[model samples]
Target: MGLIELPAELRLNIYEYFLLRHTRIKGGNQPNNSHLALARVCRTIHIEATPLLHTYISLRTEHQISKFVYHVDASRCNVVTWADVANDGRVMLTPQSSPVSRLFLALRKMTGLKCLRVFDCKSGVRAPDGPRFHGRVILKSEEAMFPDDGAMARSTPIETYKLCVSPTTRSTLFTNIPPTHICTLRLSGDCIFPDASDFSSLRELILDAVTGNHFDRRALDSTFTSSRLETFCYRMGGMGSLELRDSHLESLRTGIGTTIRRLALVGCSRLTGNGLAALFDQLRNLTYLALDMITVRQLQVGFIRVLSPKLELFKFAITNVSYAQPLIAEEVMLCDEIESLIDRDQPPQSMHLKLRDEVLQSSGRWAKWETMVKHRGIDLRTGVWGTEELQ
Candidate 1:
């Protein structure tokens, strides 16, 4: 039978399967030939698969964007929904090659867009003048492309955002970010001074690699006003302080404002034992906490004594051996106890309760917990606290 001989539904299903299959093989990183190859075999396939192919176009050059816009027409890929533009020292931000502006026009065409991410490439494609994009656009700036294209006015209508860029970007985007639509946000790296307008609609925020200098006391006040915020992730990057002030910590504990449920810190070198203790005192609803590359010495002898009661999952990566040695020794004792508990019983029914209360409760070390949990015949998948709840 000819290519056109097949029913529309069957053809579309096959095209979708191939499109998804190719996307999986490429790790969902870029557009590949599979889309184009399918389009070439028949006119029917080309017409049907154009939207799917244009759904995600990773264009790096002005020429690429212009060509794509011309072929798909401004409306077809205008909502060029999701993009990953890399500023790898290749694209320079200029009036002609402004990446953000081109992206804005592409988004205008995409009336159905929901998420947009921008990475800088050395090629500077200027933001073209056209209809505006009305979706959630995340402009993660790795270069000096902020406050350039009248960005704030363009972004004022977006429903949500996740920004991690240089200082100037915060100033420009904050003014434009609509106060009503934002629900979840992630901000990292120092940007422009934040005002109350910046945090009006935020619900959940993940601040990673944030510099303390950027977060003045006033910004903290505005950003935390989101009573709806339920989760916050902070991945510390060699900044030698907890950077969280007393007011920020107090708001969480009082439950008068936002109640953060999950808090994570990775490689927070400056946060002292007291600093962490103070932060923990505020998270009344905290259920999961993960601290990576933190000095074990900071986890004082009475650390888990106060914190472990409410925590369901805790992860700590021991960076310093001197601090971990004592904990390792304690873990050895717990292991020996579990073995004894198992040997003492005919089938070791008591091992589950013993493992849960003794080993997992006290130590944050993942390796030790893995060893003890497996020894008790509990599958790690089913045994872990939140693994079952993951959708």
Candidate 2:
């Protein structure tokens, strides 16, 4: 029997396996030829696969947005559940005739859009129109782009919103969103902290590389305590002027510590091992824990041991050790304990350990730890000094 001669349900499963892979557009400008090729196999297959192809739409440039609006029909537009608008360094906040206005017009047509991400490139972007750009031009332009309150009410509510734009532009953009419907919020770059009252329905909060200068201590504390957040990730980039301290961990412990399942604190150098141990002790319900490039003090083993028994995955990366202090016996024991924890067939199904070359050279026990890590089939990553800086 031919492939098309098979049952409809079986054919749909095969199409989904291939078509679902392209649902998330990850920093790319090119379309997958194989997905497009599969959609063109036959009339029946094309009818079944075309909707899947258009399920997740990513428009990176002004031309792409314009093409999508003009080419995609209403039926295909209705099938789109997620849309990403990444203006790769282009001046989007211009006059009413700008690309952003066109992009919003396209968004209005996507009746099924449940998630929207508006992010920009890290560098190479030009400055705004002028000093008056943000105060007047950008606000006026955004007003024209975003739908009115009545129109937004009629449209499908977006559940997830991810933003990576300049700090000044964040507030104006947020005003357009229906705050009550947003369940997940991901903020990247140097954006200001969000007010908790604005997103009453927020469940998962992710802050990636956000600077601490814009964060208000009182606002952050209230946000954690007030919101019913389930998953929280705060990853700081570089050595900022302000870092998350032990007091912040206290806030987390008192706030959502009992309810949170997954937590990641990367590059939070100010968080001591003792503070983390205290926080982990309170977080009895945590299932996944990731601590990358965090400061490890005397309580290295204590903190790791305090991890919740419900934990399923642990990712830990060691920072560069000073020649003055050298590797202590506790640090070596910490490694041994981690290996034993992974060896057990309990809650933590997977464990990852990252070490610096200098750290391995500082102690021979770490080499033995590396062997044990390999024997236990734990994921291990190693890096040299200055490698991250160059990248």
Best by lDDT: 2
Taking every candidate in turn, the Cα RMSD to the unseen true structure, in Å, is 9.6, 5.9
Give the per-residue lDDT of model 2 (tens digit) for 39-112. 77889988987767667776665566677789878998898887766544222343532432356667777888
Model 1 misplaced regions, further than 4 Å = 1-59, 78-80, 85-101, 125-157, 164-171, 198-200, 238-251, 254-258, 272-285, 296-298, 301-313, 321-391
**lDDT (C-alpha) at residue 25 in model 1:** 18
TM-score of 2: 0.74
Best candidate per TM-score, number?
2
In model 2, residue pairs whose N, Cα or C atoms come closer than 3 Å (at least 3 residues apart or on different chains), thus clashing, are: none
Clashes of each: 30, 0
What are the TM-scores, per candidate, against the unseen true structure?
A: 0.57, 0.74
Which lDDT tens digits does candidate 1 get at residues 1-391? 8657889888778777876555431311334334557778767778997777666555555566556556666566555454433332222334343335354444445555444443334455544333443332334342223233333344334454544333223223354335456566556445454355545566566665455454544545455554456666665544342355445545555542346666665555445555456666656566666554334443332233334234555544434434443354444353453334333322222211212333544555446645755666533331322211110
Model 1 whole-model lDDT (C-alpha atoms): 0.47
Give the CA lDDT, 0 to 100, for residue 272 in model 2: 76
lDDT (Cα atoms) of all candidates against the true structure: 0.47, 0.62
